[model samples]
Target: MEREKIISDVRSKAGGCFQKGEFYCSEAVIHTLNEFLSWPFDRSIVRLAAGFPVGIGRSGCVCGAISGGVMALGMVYGRDPGNAMDSRMFPVAAELHDHIKKLYKSTCCRVITKDLVFNSPERKAHCVKITGEVAAWVADKLLNDEALKDKIQPVVV
Candidate 1:
């Protein structure tokens, strides 16, 4: 299927944020990249959400969408320097983070949902939902039409 559709499906089905196995939802993003851009799944997603859940206004640290977007960007443009001089990931990460920040201020879980309490299962479920929605939306946007690339983004993304 199309990339955006995949993300949307993930968002709808997964219900919310990262719930251990929820990485399965991330699989959609990975599969979309592989099909459309020939990108690898594992490394791409790890890099994408590197500082995510934490950053995603969940008191965790970073936004999952920013992390996921950065991962997608890396899949599209990442290059291993064979050493430690590579800086490509950081800039792309920053760009994605900026994009997400613009969409949702603070990029903190507390900021996104004021009542979130990490210790509660229900709260965790809510956080997961938010993460899924954001990740899918961001992934959909980045996967938009480019002639060379695939068309993915819909109104939600």
Candidate 2:
């Protein structure tokens, strides 16, 4: 498939998952990538992101969507145990972080979500949309970035 289409699909799929309550924002981002990337991670690996929603248990230190997006990038570009962190990974993650920061003007969940209460319908809808946008942002960066794409392992399954 074309990379653009794949990225678009990632956005749609992530959004769908979040809106459906199939997963939390963080899980939705990483899980969608994992599914599209052929589960490069063990399915259970998604558990690592569960605590990240609502900004590390609602303290709101960082946007869980961005954190999860970066985690998705790590699964793709992170180094193995035998080596130092891959040179390409941090830059890609930074690009994603910068993109989100530039768009929303902040990376704190509380800042981004300040207008809406967690239990409100508006908050749920907005968060679902952010989940999709973040997934697309990261996936688009990775798929089009030859430096990172070339370094990724071929999908295992």
Candidate 3:
């Protein structure tokens, strides 16, 4: 129940999801976030992230982990129709973006995995690591930010 353990657990679950080949990078992130947030959105919401893996359908543009992290952020910070937008949305999303960029030097999957052969173990490991880190980063943000934390509904047993 410690804070660090909670964040690390989110990372492990996301990474394990990808490692088990049950979900791709983006789906793992959305799935983990949805679960951690107690199903605030339907599980089907993962479909929105399905197209993001392999850098937006394998064109290798933005990192799928980054894309999923943004979506995860949106789940909490996003606004509904006719409601005022949460001011924290853009900045928080940008923070995730910048965090990945700073660590990897690029948010492009192609760039990040450039040295590894496609579908090779190295590539899969790299993606799995990124997926876990991104999930952890999102978890840390959600757990630490008071405004964002307030948005989380209590989990129903």
The candidate scoring highest on TM-score is: 3
Local distance difference test, each candidate: 0.51, 0.81, 0.88
Q: What is the RMSD of candidate 3?
A: 2.6
User: Considering only N, C-alpha and C atoms within 3 Å, which residue pairs clash in candidate 3?
Assistant: none
Candidate 3 C-alpha error for residue 23, in Å? 0.4
Models ranked on lDDT = 3, 2, 1
Q: Which regions of candidate 2 are displaced past 4 Å?
A: 145-157
Q: Write one digit per residue (lDDT tens) for candidate 1, span 1-157.
A: 6665666765653343256554532343343344334334543544444334544434555545445545566665567777453465576567656655686666655575556665577765655665565555545555553643533333222
lDDT of 3 at 132: 94
Encode model 2's per-residue lDDT on 111-157: one tens digit a residue.
Answer: 99999987798998888888999988877766666655544322211
Instruction: After superposing candidate 1 on the true structure, give the runs of residues whose Cα lies further than 4 Å from its correct spot.
Output: 1-4, 13-52, 56-59, 82-99, 145-157
For lDDT, the strongest prediction is: 3
Cα-lDDT of candidate 3: 0.88
Model 3: per-residue lDDT, tens digit, 2-38? 7877877888888889999989999999999888887
